[model samples]
Target: MQKPSIPKGTRDFGPAQVARRQHIFNVIRRTFESFGYAPLETPTLENLSVLTGKYGDEGDQLLFKVLNSGDFAKDVTAADLETGSKALLPKVAEKGLRYDLTVPFARYVAMNRGTLTFPFKRYQMQPVWRADRPQRGRYREFYQCDADVVGTDSLLCEAEIVLMMAQVLNGLGLDDFTIKINHRAILDDIHQAVGGVVGQEGSLYVAIDKLDKIGRDGVTQELLARGFSKSAIDRLFELLSVKGTYLEKIHALSEHIRLSIGTDYTGYTDLREVYDILQASGFKQFDRLEFDPTLARGLSYYTGCIFEVKINNVQMGSVSGGGRYDNLTGSFGLPGVSGVGFSFGVDRLYDCLEALDLFTSTAETPTRCLLTHFDAASGRAALPLLAELRAAGIPSELYPDASKLQKQFKYADAKGIPLVIIMGPEEAAAGVVKIKIMQTGVERVLPVGEVVAALTVE
Candidate 1:
């Protein structure tokens, strides 16, 4: 017999885990709605053509392609087979699991361009798959909570996204995180400062984005391995090593750009304005916000400012990340629609919260009270009371079987239910019910009519 197993990088969440994850999703959703963003949903699978080439070369390699349903191998040409999987991919597969929500969202906007309003504000919470190797805080299948605003280039859109991120993180009780902001144009300027290869600036930025993970020495070695000249490497490091307050770093970067590129750039000004806006919008009260020049978000779609969120005390990957994409939809036949958005890495954030022991009291159980009885007659008598509790907006469940008393209590305990209701002969005869608090082992006998009021109060 085969042993039961699940694929690596995937997980089966138990009751408690699901409850905590749902709490995270609910907090993010409520925050999205409060900001006037409507909900959106896209399919789990997208056309292979629609997904490829959007997430850059590295991302494209991580996509999980689906095989054609019927006799897929028969259509494979001898020449295609000789050339291997890369050449034969199109012949066998035409659809793939979505790698990220942002790309599918672009496809959705393009397909529905005629019907939707301009400057649409939307949020999506869905699972995305990647063919990535599983590790701590990383998974092959996970959820992304994304909120975006498209059809406008207003910097206020960017400001609103920053504000929304702050609200979502705060709602989740993740207060010790930092929002690191940077601009692709600023990276472009830095690239130019070192006279970087004319057409490879994006590639250079992608490498620089790994500095936080790999450290400065590692980044230097990587740039060297990527064929960066000594002068270019030196200039890039100079900009990266500049240290000061947020404003001071902005000033130093402005001076570095003027000296190295011999031209004026708006990146410094953009960073300053965003900082001021976030300050005026009350973001500072919640978490640290900084102008981090070294933050090079690896996505190829980002056209303007980018944001990466990091939990201060925990050692983990970014908990949230995204930026402005000026022409994502344009690549799919709609031209000139610009947008700004961010996505929370649901798994990583959950791990961070768990490490800090922050999920207690916030993760809500589905069934608040489990109603049990000693026998068939008592179980039948408890039905009306269970209905009353549910009608009164309490999440109450009645154990269907008149199982052994100990077995019923074990079920309630195993489910992490907070309260258990007992309707046995003694309690039924007294016109009262016994309530046990699972955590505290506290017991109380209350009149049948007052049970709902008492549970509701507690």
Candidate 2:
């Protein structure tokens, strides 16, 4: 048999990695909760129809089609196959893995319209699949940390989302980040300023999304190659280079940037705005932010303000991106509702933390105290001690098999357990435990309280 292997664009996170990931998710979840957003989840698979046209043509092509269940090949024929994979799909395929959480959420809201209250706010943490060639930091299967508020067209929601982005980064101990802001209308403004090019309109947003990858020059060349006149490309650049604070826009496009999303007026000024809003309400600490005009997130669906977060020195793609989708619910038959939100790319953020050495020691290895199995009788005697450690709210585990002290210590050290509790014949008899500092190789005899206090001191 061929050697076993997993698919590309996927990963198997070990225990250590899972712990680190959990820490990151907890940070985002906590921040979202503080902002009054509730938690939600959408399924992994959605009807092929629900996903097809929502993400534009390029995104639609990246969808992973799920074949019809059991006896899938019963209807296949050679002639049908000869026409090509696309031609043969109807006989077997009916559903597809979700490309993103947003569309599925739209469907969810529509399905539960009457049962749910208006202006619903929910945050969803779930894995989404995209069938594209993966690269460093980008994966085919990854989790999306999304927070969306629907049922109102409030600029306050947009401003709050901006603040929420800053809060999560600041919470992650990431003080250095930029929240690039853009609006789809601003993109439309640029396109219109380019003298109303015909085919250029459709691909305008897609080309803009490549701003980070190709830079201005490359993007100009791409637009030209795609039938845009050099004049149109130059016009596009003119609009892109108009850099002023989002609050000081020179026109309607600029004014929209300044207007607080989900509100009638702009909130506060710059990155401190989030802090100002939260601090006034008893929350402090915030992250840095920048207003990058070319941040074209959710190109086709996002209707209003958009955002992207990036760690300053790290050389990876965005750690998060999202925007306002005004008519998303309408696509599912609920008209006139607007929502603004953002998503954290958890895996990319994890990789970024690793690269920057920001992931703490605890994040990497969470299990701290390991109770060694000294002997069968000693192991039985040590059970209560383990219970006490756990009762004190410590992540303590017992070595199931009674192994040699050295071997058990080695196992605990490998797993980065900071302290190893040794309860051998002598210690058990004496009602004492030998706490060994696995990192420092310092051993000391202590009572249960003392052991708890020692482990508690980080």
TM-score of 1: 0.95
CA displacement after TM-score superposition, residue 323 of candidate 2 (Å) = 0.9
User: What is the model-wide C-alpha lDDT for candidate 1?
Assistant: 0.87
After aligning candidate 1 to the native by TM-score, how far in Å is the CA of 362 from where it should be?
Answer: 7.3
Worst 10 residues of 1 by lDDT: 281-290
The alpha-carbon deviation from the true structure for residue 342 of candidate 2, after best TM-score superposition, in angstroms, is 1.0
TM-score of each: 0.95, 0.87
Q: In model 2, which regions exceed 4 Å deviation?
A: 73-87, 248-287, 363-366, 447-458
lDDT of 1 by residue, 210-242 (tens): 988888788878888888987778888888887
Q: Tell me how far the alpha carbon of residue 358 in candidate 2 is from the true structure, in angstroms, after superposition.
A: 0.6
Clash pairs, candidate 1, are none
